[model samples]
Target: MLKKNLLAIALLLCISSVFGQEMRNCGTMEVDARLLTEDPGYALNQAQIEEFTQTYKSSETGATRTVITIPVVVHIVYNNASENISDAAVLSQIEILNEDFRKLNSDAGSVPALFSGVAADVEIEFCLASVDPDGNPTTGITRTSTSKTSFSTTDLMKYNTYGHAAWDRDSYLNMWSCDLSSGLLGYAQFPGGPAATDGVVIDYNYFGGPAYAASPFNLGRSATHEVGHWLNLRHIWGDASCGTDYVSDTPTHNTANYGCPNYPHYSTCSGSPVEMTMNYMDYTDDACMYMFSDGQKDRMQALFAPGGSRESLLSSEGCGGGVAPTCDVPGSTSTTGITETEATLNWGSVAGSVGYNVRGRQVGTATWTEGYTTGTSINFTGLIADTDYEWQVQTDCGGGDLSAYISSILFTTSGGAATCTDIQEPNSSTGTAGTISTGVTYNALIANSSDVDFYKFTTTSPNTKIRVTMTSLPADYDMQLLNQKGKKKGTSQNGGTSDESIVWNVNSSGTRYVYVYGYGGAYDVADCYELIVEVSNSSWRTDGSELLVERVLDNAIVNIFPNPASNTMQVNYFSVQETEITLNVYDLLGNQVQTLHSQVVQGENLIKVDVNTMAAGLYIVEISNGKSSYTEKFMVE
Candidate 1:
């Protein structure tokens, strides 16, 4: 049995020689120096931290020392199966860190009598994060597969390009493990650097204990040393001859010592005192390095103190003990009561929902005309004739925890005539104003006493003078022509709709809107009234005293489509007479791509521009009447 055991040990050593690194090399100082040249602010921030460390005093032991538990997020960026380590390996690393920092390791007794009195427990612990930044549950280990074989000290492993992005650095200790460049075991970013690259890194080959790691550098001490640098601990020799490590109790050393050194190893600096080669921050082999001095403990704990650099970490809920987040989407949705101008939507309620947010739009449009409601069903009116529409419902669970919007429900409206019944039934608000072309007569009914109609139109320079005629009357109705802002510019209140009209003049040409409603709840459900909007150069004149009109309109008669060609997104423009207009299409970068000079008839003009040749993005359609320009943007995807 003894001969067999010896052969097994020899076999293990041979395998380790293939993958193990014989010497430890940390790149923390090199990375810091490179960043100091790249960013001046990083240098200034580091200087302030050094200034604080030089002035602010820390104590090793007291009732004031509180054990700090830091939440940790481990990003495993790997190129192959071997580099993608298991969760067990990560848990082992966490266990080793806790044992070493608390001075609870089984090998703590190996410290020499001369240094045992000064050996200290740093009073710091770490935990795999239980909650993610999005308030969702997490396993704390993020695994990402990469195409690159290895990463270097440039921090490519800490970003989403080749690896995983860091969690909120202020709330979690971000650690990345990957295949490092040859001979580079690990590195750490010190405090007071850019948050994007702030973290510690380790090679996957040296990430865990003996069960999964190689020899010489195995046992996870590589992380212990790098983490020390993350918390502001420097090399024992300070990376220079007879240099200071900013700690008071550590004996001054001439240079770094490698492997296991015999005790009473004398330094050539000052009185040539015995060096503490067993310190975790030294270059000694893993089995030879163990304890931290009391001075080092105080410096590590300073990060959690008030006004300290990492003080905000104490309030992080990433480790648990907070209200759990809960929100869910709607269930079992259906549409009913379809009509040319009306419809209804219904859905089942989700648990924990106090209310719901609902919105609807034409199938190709981007904006949703909606609001919040406590009811499970919503009635929609002022819908376009023979058009497809989509709407969504979301559950609101209070405390700002809102669920995802449920899948959209689609429905198409039935086609109908424009007479007798109010085709634009729901244009009750300015936000839902219906489109009306100049000189086109519309016959719509007054459904009830509270029914109102709003109509909008676009006019050109020759058509700046406006004339709206409302001849047939069902009740005493009123009309108000307003600017695009819904401000009333003119009104005509001829008693009993005795052929009411509004004629005025303006210096400019653009879109204008009008509102029509009954006076004091008057209506005739069966009769339809005729209304029309017209403009000319010299027909009607205004005295600047009053206004007149006798018609009504409903919700929007336009659509916005994020597609190559949708309902073609009609652009409305009118002139007092027949004329030619120039239309141009330009990309978002201000480069013109298409132009067309077309003749617009005296009545309604429908122009469709083909965008199948363009790539997916946003574009602007401009219409110029040789006097003024009207522009609207559309998307193709």
Candidate 2:
């Protein structure tokens, strides 16, 4: 018996080693799938979540224009001293989140112009909770020491019995940083899941500043990506072959993209479209992925809309103000002459200020090396190459009390050499136009902020719809559509790392021109934008019948009602033809509690389920026609 037990343990260890070797792994899907199999109620909750999201997206009044601030509580579960990350590292992650979500990251300029128009300022902010759950002042960070060297999706790290328990999840976004057993970087529970474990779990090594974080995954993007899932965003690839991530703006990816990929990496899926490797939802390295699409922002913002799963966080006091300050906030900060090891930082001169206290540090480092500058500009030296750094300025008002430090700005040192080669010139007008077709993709560098590129194409037939898209790198680029006479027919000029797109349907078969220019004359030699012009003759209609067809194909119009039921629940379903169906109920552990075999005729069918004797927790109801399946979740009272 002892020998057999030893053999079993060895085999388990071997299996873990094999599965944990991947460089990047997210346990969200695994955990979610387990929940769907065990807890029958999770299905209904997810359906309601989808319905709420759809309602918010369709209602003009439900649009979330204002910024929503979420209170964050970081729980550090460390087995050793080094695992207890520093406050500076924690602060750096918070700052990075603020920048990335608001489209203020220093690398925002690197997004290709083709995708920049869809990039969004999520208008969401995160701040450390100033008060604990007990109404006491807190730093919004907690630490717990454990004997376990590692953890997995069993959530041992989330409970106080083993490591740390979450705070009030409804009022705070709980983030637990720990040493995960596998190579898993992180995972998050989507909205509508159990509240006790409702938050994001990040591997401690991948959670914070550079001093402790590992390379390739070190820029604090792991938390950014996981938080995205917590806010209801799915993988850009939809976690399946040619899957739909449910966001229209993001291009369909066949699978995850790891590391940094060159621009215009074409997908092998239908249409052979170019992949968006830089999207945060992809599996790329931290420094590689930078932007989120507008559609993704809409989905995230829906959680804060009224009647949404996370709406309660809207009233949280986690970010309540502190004591008033005497000094004014600094403004108008800028960086210039950036190189591999040096950068020049400048800020607006503050009134009543005698001297400025400047502090700078490599991103993810704990301590800020300080410098005193009497003038408006200061030159920083001894910086690392291709590294991200942040600096802040404070006013010294002569007395002992100095003004508060203003918001920090981020800058990245130049990479030693550039590998870009797609440089094009003399394509600014019809005479010098670069010939392009509907299906082919072209690449070019703006060279500088002042540079612009032009291309010309001829329509083969009347009633053709032309689409011109430009994606830029490290700068904002805009596009304009012009007729053969050089008259501007349409333009798209979204700000930040968003892409620019211009579509025009013409009745006449003639030559047309496309003008691509940088926004605010911004450009970079190392980064290039991709341009794809697609011309199609298909009739363009405004009616939304196409979208309806897509929905019906995805699901057979199944509905469940009287959720949080006390006695009975109704399942109403529609099918085009008569089919045999099976209904099953599951618990949270993925165990089948009950099953019913039934048949449905063409059109609508109603089936009633009695839940009076069921347990008072979440349950899942899964209906299958042997060909397809639909699941919903509900609660028993």
Candidate 3:
């Protein structure tokens, strides 16, 4: 029996060696030392580490499972196309991160028998940050569309388009995932280096792909391995010619050998037995690897030392707790005539809240009853009439701390005869031209209100159609929605026909605003217009058909499409005017592509850009109208 067992072990080792030898080139890979030595890279030195260690409480306990939680932010830089992965993909990666660190990888059980016994679960947890550096609520993900690809990972830290947002590095781990050059799976900025770029960058392929196209294994766990390096964990092969991973329990080898390897292996590094192929730090097929040694855990812990970039993250405030200086309150109100069952709630974000603890109490009632509050907002089922209620929210910061709470706010449900008014004047300085009312009141006097083009108010106890009548309009017009930044989000034209009076289906529990932009460049004579929005007991609400039109109107690009135009030609100008414009064409090899039109209108002016006179090869169309110029690529079809 003993002889059989030895033979079986020997056979398994041989198989492991073969498995570990499988090779696949990840493509012209080279680590930029200059870039990697930043905050999340080689930003920290021995002095910094020592200083941080002095402040570490671990010297007090010396426990391996120090129970440290790292906040993370995922930036997605992609073309506006499908490469801009869904929000679910980003969240899924976060879930996988927590699972891997906790030794909860679903494939751990499938790990080879020889390595299963050594699978070490690195005790750690990752979470999407709730508070930004300025302490505002965040989903921890930012998206940007850029014409440039193959962005250097280090440059990502400096450009806002990449992910630079003055974030608190110690409290947040920044990770950028994008389309990198083919073959390169991913690279990370190690901690304790020059103080520049911070975080990891992975080509989108390995980020969420099935795995084979990018290499190793499937299920897109490359982020797991790269993030390990991000936390200061070295590759399982010790990142040296001698593949000794330094961890006492791991075997020795003469360099990292990718692919599955046999157990109890032999190595050329001083005749030491084969190395541990299942280390999380090694570039192995995901299915064949599982484990993070205790030494790696120690290195990661060392990163959070006092002076390290991850130092501030160890604080209570950094962990998402303590008294919130901001409002952090959650409140809901309803529109009249609409059943009080549905209310729209808007509130400030509370710190440490995994979610929220929203509870409410009816008017004239002292006992506060618990209400729904899992996500940012919730829909209530049954509600009373002609009643006022107070609501409050508490932060669910992990750990045992729960004393954090926001003050309550009161809102009454309208029983009948609702009058919704704005606390401030309706803004009219900004909005889509011809889509808003630019009457007298929209002039210079309304300073703070300039950001708000309009305001809306609704009551729920009863539903109603708000008949907005202009009592003092020099001329009548419509309104448009404005985003938080005072940018036009939606627009509606009044057509300059009659003294405009528009009817809006306002929700009983929802209130919003639209700004007015006067057309014809003439300011209304009325000093202050009266908008007596009448509310009727009608169950009419705006179906989801409302469209949010976001147009780029800067005239920045003069795009001419169908260069080798046949019949219909389109010229896209950021700001096309009614004036005539000119277009010139040029050909390849330093020659003129073509000039289809000599004069075209300003806005979306389409000219034949006479491609009929051109050939069936490549060409460029340049459009210029004294004010701006744009070039576009087209071919004769």
lDDT against the true structure, per candidate, is: 0.72, 0.73, 0.50
For 427-450, candidate 3 gives per-residue lDDT tens digits of 334332223222222221112212
1-637: candidate 2 lDDT, tens digit per residue: 0010000000011122223333457788766764554344565677678667766766743354879899999999998987888888888889888989999988888899989988889999999999766455789998989877888865768766456767778789999988886678888888888766889999988887566688778888899999999999888876654555667787777777776788988877777778888988888888898998888888898898778899899988777754434666568999999998899999998888788899988653436789987788899999865667888888777776577676558898986444456645777666787777777877787775467888888887887767666654456667788889988888765443455555565667888888887654455566677788777775222221111111111124455666667798877665668877889997544667789887888766778888878876666678887765656556665
Tell me the tens digit of each residue's lDDT in model 1 across 1-637: 0010000000000111223447777888767655543443554465456556544543324335768898998999999999999999999998888989999877889999989998988888989999877566889999999977888776768755468766778899999999988577899988887777888999999998888787787888999999999998888876655655767788887877877889989999777889999999888888999999887876777666777778888999889864454688788899999998778989998888889999988653335789788879899789876666778888898888887676567888885543475677678867787788888998776666578888888887844778777768856777788886888888775444345567666657888887888754455555678889878775342223233232211110111232234335444443445777777876533567789888877644556666666665545566667654444445554
Give candidate 3 misplaced runs (Cα > 4 Å): 1-32, 35-66, 110-118, 161-166, 194-196, 209-217, 243-246, 262-265, 305-309, 316-637
Looking at candidate 2, the ten consecutive residues that score lowest on lDDT are 1-10
Which number leads on lDDT?
2
TM-score, structure 1 vs. true: 0.50
lDDT (Cα) of model 2:
0.73
Error of 2 at 75 (Å): 0.6
| CA RMSD of each candidate after superposition | 26.8, 26.0, 23.3
- Residue 521's lDDT within candidate 2 is 47
Runs in model 1 lying further than 4 Å from the true structure: 1-21, 58-63, 326-637
